[model samples]
Target: MATINPVKFIQQVRAEVSKVVWPTRREVLLTTVMVFIMAALAAAFFAVVDLLIRTGLSGIYGIFG
Candidate 1:
């Protein structure tokens, strides 16, 4: 079994955290807006596809019933 020293682990964690390049506020906001736009577009596309499928199924039932 490998043993981990708590003090050494904490020092390594802090070092790694300091090396991280955090995203700027502008970049975060732009990406958030893009995600919302993509989500809305995806929802709209799925709604249209559902409507088309429903219409097709209804037509099929009407023809057979």
Candidate 2:
């Protein structure tokens, strides 16, 4: 295996970092909004399913109580 020189290694790392494509502020805002919207929809869906299951189990338990 080849060993890296400290200064050259740092330069290479900086070069690679400079090549990265970063999102703009507007793009980040749009993506964040979409994520929240999807999360809210998923939460609503699970809440309905959970309510149905709880109601069903309560009825089953009441039969023996």
Candidate 3:
């Protein structure tokens, strides 16, 4: 294996980092909001499904037990 010099490695790392396209603040905010919205929607969907299943099981037990 070849070992890299620390100074050269730092320079290469900075050069590559400079080429990155960082997101704008507005873009970041929009994506963050969308993620929260989707998470809330997913949580709500699962809550409804769980309630339905629980209600169904309760009904079945009421009849048999």
Candidate 4:
């Protein structure tokens, strides 16, 4: 196994990072909006699931009552 020097490793990392394609501001905003939309959808799904579970448990209690 070859041992790496920290300074050389950091330089190599920086060189690779320079080659990355960064997103534009508008694209970032659009992605952020989509992320929020997805999060909202997930929350809504869990809310429906929670309501169904609560309703079912209440129905079981009603039977015992």
Candidate 5:
């Protein structure tokens, strides 16, 4: 098995972390708003589809019954 060096590992981790480009506050807020908007739109679409399907099934039952 190879030997492990704790000090060298910590230094490498810090170096990589420093290279990361973190998102700005504006970008985070915009993306968060977009996510909420998309979620609401999706929920509205599914609700309409469900209503249409239920109405169709009820009509079909009424015709047969």
Candidate 6:
């Protein structure tokens, strides 16, 4: 592989960084809030599923034991 010069590499990195479309503060906040909401919903869903499974297993074991 060919080695890139340090100065050229730094210039290329800066050029790429400048081309990025960074999110605005409002957009960032909205996305963060959405993420939190989705995470909470997922946690609740898993908790309910876990409770159902545990109850089902307990009932089965109770009948057999």
What would the per-residue lDDT of candidate 3 be over residues 12-47, giving only the tens digit for each residue?
Answer: 999999999999999999999999999999999999
Across residues 1-65, which tens digit of lDDT does each residue of candidate 6 receive?
99879999999999999999999999999999999999999999999999999999999999998
Top-down TM-score ranking: 3, 5, 1, 6, 2, 4
Stretches of model 4 off by over 4 angstroms after superposition: 1-11
Better of 2 and 4 by TM-score: 2
Question: Backbone collision count in every prediction?
Answer: 0, 0, 0, 0, 0, 0
Residue-level lDDT tens digits of model 5 in 3-34: 88999999999999999999999999999999
Model 4, 6: alpha-carbon shift in Å?
A: 7.0
Q: What is the lDDT of residue 14 in candidate 6?
A: 100
Q: In candidate 6, list every pair of residues with a backbone clash.
A: none
Each model's lDDT comes to 0.99, 0.98, 0.99, 0.99, 0.99, 0.99
Q: State the TM-score for model 5.
A: 0.93
Candidate 2 per-residue C-alpha lDDT over 1-65 given as tens digits, one digit per residue, 9 for 90 to 100: 99879999999999999999999999999999999999999999999999999999999999977
Provide TM-scores for the models: 0.91, 0.82, 0.94, 0.76, 0.93, 0.87
Pairs that collide, model 4: none
| TM-score, structure 4 vs. true | 0.76
Using TM-score as the measure, which candidate wins? 3
Residue 19 lDDT in candidate 5: 100
Which of 1 and 4 is ahead in TM-score? 1
After superposition, which runs of candidate 6 have C-alpha atoms over 4 Å from their true positions? Answer: 1-3
Candidate 4 residue 14 Cα shift, in angstroms, is 3.4
**Alpha carbon deviation, residue 26, candidate 5 (Å):** 0.5
Off by over 4 Å in 1: none
What is the Cα-based lDDT of residue 55 in candidate 2? 95
